[model samples]
Target: MATYNPIRDMERFADALLEGSTRGPRRMPMDLYRDGDNYLLTADMPGMDPGSVDIDIDGQLLTIRAERTLPKAENVKWITRERTPGSFLRQLNLGQGIDTERITANYDNGVLSVTIPVSERAKPRKVQVSTGAPAGVDSSEVVVSEA
Candidate 1:
């Protein structure tokens, strides 16, 4: 007969419970990058429908929320369940130059991609220099003696 260490087993069980409890809807991971004139955000959302996702930008905060309902089987017994299926919510703080009105989003192959265009004022512009003086200026100089 083999004897198990109850203390170690209790520690592992506690750790697992803490990890699962902290993984509520606010823990979804995402990747963000800047490409030319737009910012791209990619989030992994497998088994979720595009219609169940909601994206909103208020001021400089961007929020992404999604909900998924797992299919129920009448008489199926689950041997193992690993993948997490639940609602997810993620919020990202955007920079001031982001143009919220022009933001666009697309979902494909279980990945969600959001493109936020930069505002015109935030784009770099070249300043034109004027070399010549005023068009109506006279080049001649007038000197008056003490009167």
Candidate 2:
């Protein structure tokens, strides 16, 4: 015998209400960090079709989209259904100094990894600093260029 709990029903109702507020796309959890000269991003998307994943870059915006579908069965009653299936989306704004042309993404074991390489111009470089005067040259003998 299954007993109906009012608290559980209320919780489900609240969840549905909140979920309905964002009808477009659900947010997927992700982590982003800079590794060497590249920015790495990883998103967790379990039980998703690899082919259903789509990534796009427009200007400074990076968008990731994926779909998760649950099979529907006939003449079956669900005692408790918690996992909602639909579209998942995540957007990030990549500012200047990023090599967008060489951006790469890979999905493995339900984890999506994105590599954003830093531009050559953006990479850290050491600027040579000259000290006092060269070998036999004296500071007073040095002639500054006249524009």
Candidate 3:
């Protein structure tokens, strides 16, 4: 059985009510997945010109902005104007361990791909501790290793 959450439902209702008045820039759909020591982020931005997209990294904040302009022809009559032509905005806070300086991006077939590498300092490394006198404890103390 599904439980009803009033606060969540109310928030959705409020969003629907304000979506029309908010200038209607739809959020880009994003997929984030970790591949080994790097993260792959993909955003589906169909019909967007590759040159119009901008990626900015400020501190740990990653922002993506793109725009699609509607053709302006005086002779054209549109039967349906459902496709909204406006800016696409998406922002993400990259947590610690991300190598922001070496971040790379590519656009192909209306999809934006960003590769974020993990910093070497944040990668896991094995520390070898030989059996000997415990650093500060007794000289004949048991040596403990973390798993």
Q: Which of the numbered candidates is closest to the native, going by highest lDDT? A: 2
Residue 40 of model 2, lDDT score? 99
Instruction: For model 3, state the Cα shift of residue 27 in Å.
Output: 0.8
Model 3 ranges with Cα > 4 A deviation: 1-24, 134-147
Error of 2 at 109 (Å): 1.6
- Model 3's number of clashes is 0
Measured over all alpha carbons after superposition, the RMSD of each candidate to the real structure, in angstroms, is: 6.0, 4.4, 9.6
CA error at residue 24 for candidate 3, angstroms: 5.1
- Candidate No. with top TM-score: 2
Residue ranges of candidate 2 with Cα displaced over 4 Å: 1-12, 16-22, 132-147
* Winner by lDDT between candidate 2 and candidate 1: 2
lDDT of each: 0.81, 0.91, 0.86
Error of 2 at 46 (Å): 1.0
lDDT of 1 by residue, 1-147 (tens): 445677866876785586576346645668988899998999988888789999988899999999877777788966544455677888988878878999999999989999989999999899988765556766465455798
Q: In candidate 2, what are the lDDT values of residues 1-147, reduced to their tens digit?
A: 468889998998897776665356888899999999999999999999999999999999999999998899899988777777899999999999999999999999999999999999999999988787887988898889989
lDDT of 3 by residue, 1-147 (tens): 456677876876686576654466668899999999999999999989888999999999999999987777798866535455788899999989999999999999989999999999989899998796757878556767899
Q: Candidates' TM-scores?
A: 0.73, 0.80, 0.76
User: Candidate order by TM-score, highest to lowest?
Assistant: 2, 3, 1
Ranking by lDDT: 2, 3, 1
